[model samples]
Target: MKSIVLFGAGNVATHLFRAISNTRNFRVVQVYNRTPANLVPFQTLVDTTSKMEEVKPADIYLIAVKDDAILPLVKELIFRQALVVHTAGAVSIDALENLDRKGIFYPLQTFSKTKKVDFKNIPICLEATNPQDLELLEELAGSISEKIFRINSEQRRSLHVAAVFVSNFVNYLYSEGEAICKENNIPFEILHPLILETAVKATGMSPLAAQTGPAKRNDTQVIQSHLELLTGDQQTIYSLITQSIQNLHGKEL
Candidate 1:
């Protein structure tokens, strides 16, 4: 079995640990976090440590910390024989350039500690400077996920930006919709089916082709009515997005 030392106690780390644990070929031997309190959840399941010196030797040291902390944490880890990979989507493999066996084992999905997701469906993006190291990552990735892609740093970076637009930006828009509904004494649940269908449609076809609404239609009268209903901040955001949609569609009405 391949032993893994997972760094960070955040959402990604928590889900990764759970997923890997269910596999017979791999096991998380230890979990590390700078903060002792954050290591509490994994203490019972695996060896938990707050000190760098306490870290045990393993087949892989998977760093799942924030993007900013990746370089600093990698610099501290002195394992030359073991493969070291990070779970960051945007951060390049060069972040671990100092290490002998460096790679990326980025899972291309947003993780939540409370939300249980099937690893089988999630795309696990792998990259490595060495061929053997890449194969090792592929093997480890295959153990938990069926979807594995050998994406270069540049492609991975672009994918990360696209993910933010679809997931993070879309989530913010949902919050805005929810707020508007709440203000007008409408139950937010009424929008659930529309939200679900929109997501389903986008997955089945190109999002550009799936585009609809007053903005896509370039109905100025309807757009202006929407603007008038929104607050000053909401109007600015609505106008910006509307302009963007019309610009993409390249149609005048």
Candidate 2:
């Protein structure tokens, strides 16, 4: 069994730490976090060290820290060896400048403390400096996920950018919808079915192909009515997205 040491105690770290702790092939030998409170439950699950200087011997060290803090934290850890890795989509392996074996194990999915992620469906994008290390990463990734992709730093960056547009931007639209529903005194739950349906359709077809509603249908009267109901910020977003949708189908909507 290959032992693992994980850093950070945030959403990604918590999820990964639990998975590694449960898997028979792997053991979460140690967990480290800046705030001891954040690492509370994890400490009960496995050995934990709050200090970066208290480095533990492990086959792999998974750095799950934030993008901005990763470099500084790595420097603080003061550990010269061990297969070091980070879970950042846009960060390159060279970010671990002082380490020989380095790589990325980016899980291409949004994580929330309350949300349960299906590792089997979430693709693990991996890359490493050494061929042997890369093989080891693939093997490790396969343990947690059936869907794995060998994405280099550049491709990972591209994928991250697309993710921002799809997941993050789409979420902003949902929030806008909720606000509009609130202003109209309509229960936001009424839109839940439509939102779920839209997501489900996108799984089987491209977002473009799954497009529906007045925007896709070019129902000008419906569009204008909806726009009329919206005000200020929501109306601006509605207008922008509507124009984009019309451009999408190469026709006026």
Candidate 3:
């Protein structure tokens, strides 16, 4: 079995550990975090440490820390030439260039500690400086997920940006919808079906084709009324998005 020393105890690291635990191909021999309290959860399952120097020998050192901390952590890390890979979408593999073996093992998905994501379907993106390291990453990714892609730094960065648009932005819109419903004394549950249908439609068809709204239809009067109902930041977001939608389908007008 391949041995792994997982760094960081954040959302990505926790999920990665759980997925690896389910598979017999890989064993997380050690887990490290800067805060000792964060290592408590993994201590019973495997060796856990707060100090980086005490990290045990492993086939792979998986860094799943915050994007800003990745570089500083890499600089301080002292491994016995173990293959070092980070699970970050926006961070470049070049950050690990100082290591003997460096690569990226980014899982392309929004992770939350409370959310349960199926590793079998999540697209695991891999990149390595050498073919052997690439093969190792590929094997590890394949063990957890069937969907694997060899995405470079630039492509992964672009994918991350797009994910922010589709995932983060969409979720914020949901929050806005809920707020609007609350202000009107309407049950947010009424929008649940619409939300699910919109998601399903987006997956089944192009987002542009699935789009439907007063803005998309170029209904200026309805748009004006909606903007009048909104205030401050809400109004700004509504106006900007409405303008964008109109610009996208202006020919229809």
The candidate scoring highest on lDDT is: 1
Could you give the candidate ranking by TM-score, starting with the highest?
1, 3, 2
Model 3: residues with Cα > 4 Å off, grouped in runs: none
Model 3, range 1-253, lDDT digits (tens) per residue?
9999999999999999999999878999999999999988888898999887898888999999999999888887877589999999889989886677999999988889999999999999999999999999999999999999999999988999999999999999999999999999999999999999999999999999877989888888998899889998899999888888877876443
Clashes of 2: 0
Model 1 misplaced regions, further than 4 Å: none
lDDT value for model 1: 0.92
Reference-based lDDT, each prediction: 0.92, 0.85, 0.91
Distance from true position, residue 231, model 1, in Å?
A: 3.0
Candidate 3: the clashing residue pairs are none
Q: In TM-score terms, which candidate is top?
A: 1
What's the best-to-worst order under lDDT? Answer: 1, 3, 2
**lDDT: the better of candidates 1 and 2:** 1
Give lDDT: candidate 1, residue 205.
100
lDDT of 1 by residue, 211-247 (tens): 9999898889998888888877788999898888988
Measured by TM-score, how close is model 3 to the native structure? Answer: 0.95
Candidate 2, which ten residues in sequence have the lowest lDDT sum? 17-26
lDDT, residue 159, model 2: 91
- Candidate 2 Cα deviation (angstroms), residue 147: 0.8
